[model samples]
Structures are given as C-alpha cells and as structure tokens.
Target: MRTSALREQRHPTLTPAAIGRAATLALHDELSLTPKPGLVTLIDRGSHDDMDAHTFMRSLFSLRRYFVQIAEAGLAGAEFDVLERFGIAAEARMRAATGGINTHRGAIFMLGLLCAAAGAVLREQDEAPRPADLQRALRRRWGDALAQRSQRTSTLPGGIAARRHGLRSASEEAALAFPVLFEAALPALSTALARGLTPQQARLDALFHIMAVLEDSNLAHRGGLAGLRFAQRTAQAFLDRGGVARPGGLQEAHAIAGEFVARRLSPGGAADTLAAACWITRVCGGS
Candidate 1:
C-alpha cells in the first residue's frame, strides 16, 4: 500500500479554481491542435467564417468564472437547475465576448458539467478521481435531471437541425451522459497514447473517432443530412486507414481538413467532445 504522503503527492487536492483553470487550458489545447477537420484551430479557420482561434480564446477567458462557479456549486451539492442557470448566464457572456458569435457555446455546457462533476467527485474522495470516476459521478448525480431536460425541445440551430435530421440533440447527448465522449473519444485517445502517439496525434485521432460516431448537429445545420453523412463517412474512412497510427496519417488528416473546408462542413460538437476528452485526461492525471 502507498503511504499517505505518497498518495497525496500523486493526487493533489483539486480546488474549484484549479479545476476551472484545467477546463480552460483543455479548451486552449484543443484549439491549438492542428488539422481538425471542419473545426477552428490556431493555423486555419476550418469551416467557420465567423470565428478563429483568437475569438475562441476570448470566449474561454470570459467563461473562466462560470466554470469556477459551477465547480463550487458542485462542491456544495447544488441542484441541476441552479447549474443550468449558471450555464445560461455564462452563455450570454460567451456571446458577448465573441460579438454574438457562438464560439464555445457547446463547450460551455458540456465541459461545464464535467467540471462540476469533477468537483463533486473530489469532494467525496480522499484522492483525486479518475476519468471513469468523474464520468460516473456525472451520470449518478445529474443523469435523471439531464434526461428530463432533454425531453424539452431545443430552440438552437443544432437542436433544430437534429430534430429535422432525426439526429440526437445536444441535450439528448448529455442525457445519455455523452456516450461518444466516453465510449469513443476517450478510448480512442487512451489507445493512441498507449500506442506511443504524441499528444497531438492522440487528440487528432480522438477527434476523428468522435466525428465518425457523433451525429453532430452542427454538421447537420451547416451541410444538412447529406453533409452530416459525408462527414461521418470521411471520419470512418480515416479511422479505417489506421488513424494516426499509420504512416502518412497526419498528411491525410490535413488533406481531409481541406476537403471539409471546401464543403463548408463544421463538426463543432465533435470538436467540443475532443476538448472534453482532453479535459478528462488532464483531470485524471493521464496527461
């Protein structure tokens, strides 16, 4: 058995502020990752015409306090309704920071909940929780509430597109506790890392995995069902070609990025999930 000091050294006490900073840095890391098909990055504006990396950064800065507040709420055992109110205020702040552009809106919801879950888990444990533990905590604490929330129709573009295309809305994804993030993105990232891939390569692979499976309403909204199907097929093809494990995989991913841009298809929801995966990795001390 490990000594108390050693365990403490391994799992430092996670404060709400630290958790919030981790969430923000995870978003930054995702934005810094290159060649994400139909997503914004530091080098290219994938498929979005309204925002870039700088815009994402500004939104991240604006939402820092929101994450901290929600994390604190989780530590205090606040209800989901209260957390939703915080999220609503944060969304308004994000739009204000981005000049009415919807940068980081999806992230603010998903990552915000994840942050809160982390706080709740840490509060109940002597040591820091693992990624799986945090995920379980999220579902155990908020699954029922999330399901109830998902029952209501969404008025956002992604929700509207999902309804029209018969795809899962963002709320539905949350209600199911983000199976794509946990089952697809997280596992893909962990596998890539175990295979000795670089952080960037692993994250890229994870993003593609999410794109392959997630019915990203952003893609539906932008390119319609046809666009969503095309994006899914393209992502699946990349994974079949050995993802980041194969030789020339990075080049192929960049090529796909160009294609997605030409088609004006942006899988923003998948991109957000990729960031959430990164956040989980970091929170679980996998990074």
Candidate 2:
C-alpha cells in the first residue's frame, strides 16, 4: 500500500474512555506483582502533586516498555519457558527492580504490543491492520509466536482504566455517560494516531481529555504524593527539575516541556509546551 493509504488504514477508532481504560490496564499490567484489574485505584493512590509530563509519560511508557521487552522474548509456551529460564533467581532480581509485574501473561501481552507496533510501522506493505487481515500480519511479525499466543492462556482485556477518576464531587449521571462519550471520542484518537502521532502523544491526549471532563464533573481527588513519585521516577530519564516551588502553574511549564518533545522529534519546530503542561497537571493530580 502507498504511504498515505497505509497511514489511513492503520488508524483505529479509540475513545478517551478506551484509551484511559488501556492506560489503566497497562499500568496494572506494568506494576502489579500479581495479575489484578484495579490499577486506576492504584494510580490514584500512588500519584502525587509535583509530578510533571515527562514523569507521567515515563510511568505509562516504562511499564509498556517492560511488557514489550518480555514479549519480544517469545509468545505461547515460550513465555513461561523464558520465565522459567529466568528461574527463581532471575525472577527475584526482576521483582526487586520492577514492582513484580513480570508475569507470563504480561510477557505475552507485551510481546503482542511489539507485534502490533512492528506491524503498524515496520512490516511489509500488505501486513497492516485490516478488517479482514489478522493472521497474515501476526504471521509476518511474530512468525511462530503468533500461533503460540493464540493457544496460550492469556488474553488482552477489552480496555483498562476506562473508569473515571476519584473526584471531590462525582455524579451518577456522568458515570453512566462513559459509553456514549467514548464512542464519540475514539475516532479523534484514531485520527491523531493516523497523523503519525506517537502512542505517547495519543495516550497523553486521551488522558488530558479525561482530566478535563472529570474536573468539569468534579469526579475525584488527586493522588497527591503517589502521583508525584510516579512523576519523579518517569522524569529520571530526561530533564529532571529536581523540585519545583509550584507545579500547578500549568501554562508556562507545559510550554517548555511540549517544546522539548517537539524539538526532540523535529528540531526546527516549536516545542509542545501546552501538552507538556497538561501532562504536568495530570502527574500533579489535577482534577
């Protein structure tokens, strides 16, 4: 397929709720020592007030990255085989470094993400996501691993963290609106994805939209300290401000961070400070 055609075809409709749910699932999938589904609560409990964009993005990306790495090791029976290869000693070491999320199914899911990313961007022209195409791309990307994953015990969730956050004042009416809202929102995500926005960008946009609605509805309280710590860990990779007097200034900070990302991606363009600031607000636990 031509480049434009390929781009158009790969864009899948994703709602804010779906993306949020995906983030939640990815977070739990990333952090849980054992498999569980309540990561949104975990993040609410863990995040703090001083966290920034890089920090927020890092937390999401870090777990997703770990998942991808393990998956790359294998699929199907190979996942457990690799974990067994890690043995008690290796698993202990991983647990110490990671929060104990390194499980067999997590490994398989991570591998699936790798296959998805590769098929989306790096595979042959014919191997993109299509209504009719599934096995072909899986075959090209994972080869034997695809077959193994199908037979394996794990299955990816429909969506994770689609739940609204904890808020100062939430309404029952808004709670019921999730389905309708996300159905409309997913296409925007798909559009952004088609524009070649990185998954990080797409995910970030979805988070921002959620925060906005939650704030409007007064749904939850900020995670405070946990949010900040998550931010600190995430920002360790890039520019770490160490500490800031007031992280809630929103406007100026996002300007700087967005620009930095933009400059990194396209050195000549202006940075995306606005988006970066929004990210900071999230890590800081804004409504």
Candidate 3:
C-alpha cells in the first residue's frame, strides 16, 4: 500500500517517539524555567534538599522511553490499567535514576496521561490534537477509571495531604481532565505570549497564575493547608502587581522565590501543571 493509503487505514497520526519527545521537551521547559517559587531549576534546588537539575535530568532520561510506550499504547486504544502499568514502570526507572528521589512523580502521572491522550487524539484525527480535542479524548476514554482510582487511599504525601485537607488530589484533577492545565495554566500562558511577553516571562506568569488558584497538594504536604493558602495569596499578589510586566515585577518574583525557599514550601503540583501546559502549547501549536 502507498504511504497515504496506509495512513488512512489506521493510526494515521504522530509517531510515539515524536509524541514522547514533545512530552519530554515540555518537562524540560518547566525545569529550565527559573525563579519558580519553591521548585528546582538549573541554578538552584528551590525548597528541595534531595534533588536538583541534574536529578531531574536523570529522571527525564529514565522516563523518556516510558512516554513513548504509553503513547504507543494509547495509539492502540489500551485501557487505563495498561497506562498505569507503564507509569509504574516509569516511576521505578525514575527512582533508580535519582537514587529514590521523587523528582518527577507528579509529572509522570499528569504528563503521562496527557501523552497517552495525545496519541489517542492523533490517531483519531490524523493530526496533532488541539487542547480541547485532547481533553475531550482523555475524559471520554479514561474519566471513569481515573474517577474510580481517585477514591482509593494514597500513601503519597500530596495525596495524604489532599485527603486530610479536603482538597483535590492529582488523581482527582485527572479524573476531571485537569481544569488547571486546560482552563487556567494554558490560558494564562497563551494570553501572556499573545500580549507580547517573552517566553520566560510568559511561563513565569502562567506558573504564578496556576499557583494563585490551584489547590496544590504538594504545598499542603509541605506546610499544611495554611502553607498552600499563603502560596496562593503570594502568587495572586504578584499578578495583581502586573506579573512580570511591570518594572519591578521580576524582582518581586525573585523575592517571592526566596521566601518560598526559606519556608521550605514547594509547589510541585503547580509545577507539574505548568509542564502540562507547556506540552499543550508544543503539541497543539498554541502560541
């Protein structure tokens, strides 16, 4: 059969490897973003004592193949259990690479689902899926499974914190198709870029926007619910002062980062959400 004919027959979309590359690149974008309150970067370890940029790079290397595998499975219409198995394996590889540090655990779940959904959407449309198309595919395909999964008790600190505080866990966020990513973070990113902000500035705005609203379980895990609320207020204050657009905005953000580090409060959930937003911008051709 001709290439066109073969493409029309089935799975007429991006390669799993290409999809994986997009996912990995998204994570890298998030990691490279500096002055992120309480998050790791190339220059410093934010609030974390165990991991740094090198550790994240190692985790990224370990999970590279896992994204490809999950994307391939989604291309084949594999069930949630299949994707879960891939995630489990990816987590193991990440732990081994980082000497048991949880550098990208939340990312593995959030971005992993996104990559799978991207594969499914690509196979269906024979093109890169838009944010809306991708979200619809994910919820239609695996919403129920994620919803069921969210009910189970979790031993992870974020999950435990979420349950204890009545905030949504990452699983719950997934079960609802990641409103913060699609609704908040992506829009903030697109708007910032559209308004002529530089790439780094736009991403910083998006990260703060997410932090301003998201019930980040990692924040709660670190400093309890009060800590999470403080982070939210701080981020909102930055945006209210014109984000990175005003003269002193960047300095203000840096100051906020210093405060976060001092407090030992890491907004890992918000970081993962930011990564997912980055992935959407890349995969869906968003500005």
Candidate 4:
C-alpha cells in the first residue's frame, strides 16, 4: 500500500475523549492480563506486597483527565515543559488516589507522551496517525527535551536502579522514542494476532517478549542485576518454547509467576510497555 493511503486506513480519528478512553482501556487491559510474571493482575499480585489490581484501577481512574488534557495540549502544539507539568500534576493525583502508592507513575510518563504525540500528529497531518507516525511525532516534537531530561539525576527507585546497574532509564527509552515498545512489544503482539491468537494470548506473548529484553528497573530494584538476568532468561525460554502458542503455555506462565513472586522480582517496566503496545494497537487499528 502507498504510505499515505496506508496511514489513512490504519489511523483512527483521534479526539481528546477518544485518546483518554483508549488510554484507560489500555491500562485496564494490562491490569486484566492474568499470570503476568512479576506483575499485578486481577488474579494475583505477582511480586509486590504494596499494591494490587484495585490499586491500579484507582490509579487509572485518577489519570483519565490527565490523558485527555495532555492530548489536548498536544493538539495545541504545547511544548515539552507544558506536558511535563501535566504529568507532574497527574502523578500527584495518582498518588493521592492510591493513598501514596506509585502505581501508574511510569504509565503517566510513557502513555502520556504517546497520547500527546498522537494528538500532535492528528492536528499536524489532519489525519489519523499510524504507529510509525506517532513514533516520528514523538521524536520530532520532543526528542531533544526527552534527551535532556534523561541526563538529569533521578531519585526514584527505578531511576536509581537504572543508573546503578547501567540500564537505560525510562527517560532514555522515551528520548529514543520507545524502541522496546515500537520494536519489540508491538511486533510480538501483532505477530501473535496474525497467527490467530486471541487478544489475551497476543498480549501475554507481547508481555513475555518485552520482559525478555527490557532493562526493567523494577526487577533491578527488587532483585538487582541477577534478578534482571533471571527474568530475561525466563522470558526468553518461554518464547523459545513458542510463547502462548505452545500447549500448556498458560500453565508454564503461571509457574513462572510463582517463581517471580518467590524471588520478589517484578517486571513493571515490561508491563508498562505491554500497555503502551495495546494503546498503539488500538490507535493504529492493528489487527
């Protein structure tokens, strides 16, 4: 297909309401995916004792307006500094909703940026944006600011862990336009769907694929480099066994969840990427 024609076919009409609804649905989808290794879901809290599925729901509820507002800001061609302020306020609301628990901090940053990018693309091109367009918009609009932000010192546990272990910080990932989400998670999810897997199965496959490669600071903070390595190996092994396509795959994932919980390792970063992948799929009309 021709490039512009393909974009027209793939991109959906994006409004602030549509963007917020999609963001909320994506986060809910992520929370509903069961047996996510070292992550929270409706059935279990994989590794963390502090939060659960309900906590995540509260965080989602709190950030609904934030997503819409940020998307609106993007449509208005707001600067990076403006978006950052929105994120900060949203984080405060999230913490308040969760009673000081940091459930959706990463999502506030990652999904917020993507939402803004989508809005910007819609306004600039006067058409729906494909995944690639969103990626390009992110870089073209705020890549320099993201890079500069990546250089600042971070006091958060995830940032500290990334720094201490030489893993890419979340800011670094964003500055590079979310290579893991665009390159790995979305592709895995799309391929699974193409192979006739259900949405849940596709998401699970995407989650494992992300866990295999993401330098998840959550794992590092909880179990350090050894823990991170163990997560990657486990995820890689699952994929080697054909991921969610294999017979008994769900059982194997459950087993892995058990192991991750026992080790106190949570792939929160990977989980966030999975959510972002879902958002891209929805926004871009990916089957």
Candidate 5:
C-alpha cells in the first residue's frame, strides 16, 4: 500500500548484492507451497525481481501465502489437535516417535500463541503486551493439556543427536524448525516493530519476509542436521552481513533466539529449529 515510500527509501542493511544472492538461491531451490507434485515449481515461475522493493514486497507476500498453506498442511487435524490441546496424547505421540518425553504440545501452542500475539501486535495495532489476554487464551484452550502430567519415557535413540539427521517425519522436522525459525525471524520483526509497526504486523511481516526468501531458495527440503545447520548459519550470516535493515532488529532477534537454543536443546545450544521453537514458547509472550 505504501508503495511509493517503500520504493524510495534505501534500506540500509539489505544491499542489492545480498538480496540478489539470496534471490538466486531461492529461485534455484523452489520449495513450493503445496506438498503436491510441481505445485511449488509452478508458483516459482512468477516475477521475483528483488531489485524492486514493490516486487520484493509482492514476492515476499506471495511466499507467505504459500508457506501458510505448507505450514498449515504440515500440521493437520491430528497434529493441530495435539498442539492446540498440548496434553498427554501429544506427549505419547512424541514419545513413540522419539524415545524420550522431549517436547510438549503446550509449548508448541504457546509458540503459536506468541505468533498470534505478535501477529496481533503488528497487524492489529492492539494494546501492548496484554499478559491477561495471553494467559487467558492459553488457559482457555490448552489448560488441561498443559496440566496433564507427562510420564517420563525412555531416552531418545542416538542420544538426541540422531534426531537432527533429518530422518524424522516432516511434522517432526517442522517441530524442530519452529524455534529456529523464530530465533532467526523475531529480532528482525522486533526491529520492524520499533519502527512504528505494531507487534503482530511486525512479526507476521518478518515471517513473511523469511518465507519469501526461503521460497526463492529451497531451505525446507534440505532437512537433516546439516541442512538445518546451513539454514541457521545462513540466517545468522545474513544478519551479520547487515541484510536486515533496521536499528537493533537483527541483534535483538538473534539474542532472543540464542537464549532459546541455550535453554532448550540437549546440548544447551543445539542449533536446531525445534530447539529454537521450544525457546520461543517460553518467552514470546512478552516477559
């Protein structure tokens, strides 16, 4: 909507060269919205000239539309229910897949809620950090699930190291990526938020931006430990190289994400996405 201004102002961080490199990688990877054959490929052919801010914005939004589909589908009724409910059943499933009681749906839903909250802040222009709303919403839907006790299961096979190898199901992999995605995305969002956008809009905008970059590149498909590592490194590198154009955006998001990884992962800073998601769940509600 603010097309003219967006085009005129030179984004200090995102250089033409950096965006080009990222865009080139995105074009080659072509990770589509749907898991359906060639759907993403079909969508990939559209215009994505990162040279133009309008085009870049459009391209980013386009990717958001698609990733929302993928993210939605990656989580279906069962998985959705598990996360929304965040209870013993979800725990059981995780236990069955991994050897230990590694994660909680409560955590995932909480992350989702944080996304919802941040999305609301950025998009809605609502009041700032309504702890009551967050607590109430979480309690209303996921209260029992969170409260339901977990009967500590056996240790995970491969000592949690094997989980990162990418042999896990798509849903599991996504679960892993959730935290990492937030780690990489949230700080940029926060910086954007400080620039007069609401928290919700800022969060959604940042996520949309990342998804846009991913669409151009195919980061999601390369899902093993190495692949995830690459994604993390790339995100950090992009930030380090001043790709995110905002005052304090890159550093804040990175610090939050780093704290998350250190606290959650088995290794205390396992650079996995799921580990990042776990960390987001705890602090994303504006603590």
Candidate 6:
C-alpha cells in the first residue's frame, strides 16, 4: 500500500479533506499515465490540440477545492441540487483556468460524484470506503436524481452526438450506478495487477477494457458511431493479443495511438472512467 493509503487505513476517521485529496491524486495518476491512445499526458498530447498537460493541470488545480467542498456536502447529507451547484461552480472555475477549454469536464462530474459518494459512505460507516460502498452510496443517495438527469436533453456536444448515434451518454451511465467502472474498469485493473503487471501497465489494461465496451459519448461526438466502434475493436484486439505485457505490446499500443491520432479519435470518456478506477483503487486500498 502507498504510505498515504497506509496512513488512511491506520486511521479509521477519514475526513472529507482526505477524501478530496484522494480524488485529486487519482486524477493526477490518470493524467500522468502516458501512451494513452488519443489522450493527453504529461509527455504527450495524443490527439487533442486545444488542451495539453498544462491545461489539464490548471483544471485539476481549480477543482481541488470543489472536491473537498462536495465531499463535505455529501457527508452533511446535502441534496442533489446542492451537489449540482457545486459542480456548476467547479466547471466555471475549470473553464476560467483553462481559458475555456473543456479539459477535465468529464472528470469533474465523474470524480466529483465519487468523492461525494465516498463522503456519504464515510458518514454512514465512519470506516474505510470500499469500491462497493462508494458505488452503493452514490446510487442510494442520488440514484433518483441521476435517473432524472439521464432523461434530460444534453446541449453538450458529446451528449448531442450520443443521442444522434444512439449511444449511451455519461449521464445515462451514471444513472445505472456506473456498471462499467465497477464491473469492467475496476475488475480489469485488479486482474492486471494480480497478474503482476506494473501499475502503469495495469492502468493501460483498465483503460482499454473500458474502451472496449463503453459507448463513449466523446468518441461518438468526435468520430461518430463508426469511430466509437473502430476504437472499441482496436482496444479489444490489443487486449486479446495480450495487452502491454506481450513482447510487442508497447509497439502495438503506439500503433493504436497513431491510428487514433490519424482518425482524430479521443476516448475522453474512457479516460475519465480510467481516472475513476484509479480513484477507487487509491481510496479503497485495492492493489
């Protein structure tokens, strides 16, 4: 376990501040992982030109306080509108920080909810927040609100594109308690680590697993439904070929990255999901 994680486990009284910090760390962990197909990293901007690592950093910093505040709200049993208000304020700060770029928008929603859920779980149990605990807490506290959210028409490009392509929007995924995050992403990460893959390699595994199945609105928006399918097939093929563990795995991954760049494909939703998985791992003390 990480030293900080150990400290968290040793001390059962985890606070909103600590939960907030974990969210930030998880986002950074996702950001720092390089060679992500069509995604930005500290070393490379795989597919995006509007924003890079610097832009992402500014957005990440801008939302640090938002996570803490939301966690506090969750712990205090604040209503869904209260959480939405926090998210709206955070999004404004993110836009301001990145000069109106949409960096971390997906993350702001996904991780924001998870952080609040973790807070709610802590309030109920005052114990360590497990992945299941957080997931259940999110659904129990905000399932109805999220269900209503899913039915609303989205003016966002991703949501519009998803509706056009007959794909699932992120809000829809949230309404279902994030089956992919809990069932697909987290399990893949755990399985990869169990197989002795390096943490970086494990994350790559998790990201691809998410892409293989997620009807990513970002992918649909950028590349249309065809693009979404193409990305999914490519990701599935890579995993079937043994992922980043095989001898030529890195080369194949780079090749996939090249393809995404050429196709202007950015699996932004998958990237966000990967970040959420990282958050779960860190906060839940998963290997």
Clashing pairs in 3: none
TM-scores of all candidate predictions against the true structure: 0.97, 0.27, 0.95, 0.95, 0.30, 0.96
Q: Rank the candidates by lDDT, best first.
A: 4, 3, 6, 1, 5, 2
Q: What is the lDDT of residue 234 in candidate 3?
A: 97
Runs in model 3 lying further than 4 Å from the true structure: 1-13
Candidate 3 lDDT (Cα, whole model)?
0.91
Per-residue accuracy of model 2 over 1-287 as CA lDDT, tens digit each: 59878665455432223223343354432232111011212233122223333343334444443433332333322333353343334334444444544322222232233323233332233322231132333344444443453343322221111132322121121222222123322333444456665554543343333332322211111223233233323333222342111254234334434432332211000011112222222221221
Error of 6 at 253 (Å): 0.6
User: What does the lDDT read for residue 264 in candidate 4?
Assistant: 87
Tens-digit per-residue lDDT, 1-287, candidate 1: 46977888878988889889889988998999998887899988888888998899899999999989999988888889999999999999999999999998899899999989988987798567787787788899999999999989889999999999899999999998889999999999999899899999999999999999999999999999999999999999999989877999999999999999999999999989998999888778878
The lDDT of each candidate is 0.90, 0.30, 0.91, 0.92, 0.33, 0.91
Candidate 5, superposed: residue stretches over 4 Å from native = 1-132, 139-187, 196-205, 208-221, 246-287
lDDT for each residue of candidate 3 in 147-214, tens digit (9 for 90 to 100): 99999999999999999999989999999999989999999999999999998999999999999999
User: How far off is residue 56 in model 6, in Å?
Assistant: 0.7
Steric overlap count per candidate:
0, 29, 0, 0, 20, 0
Q: lDDT score of model 5?
A: 0.33
Worst 10 residues of 3 by lDDT: 6-15
**Candidate 1 clash pair list:** none
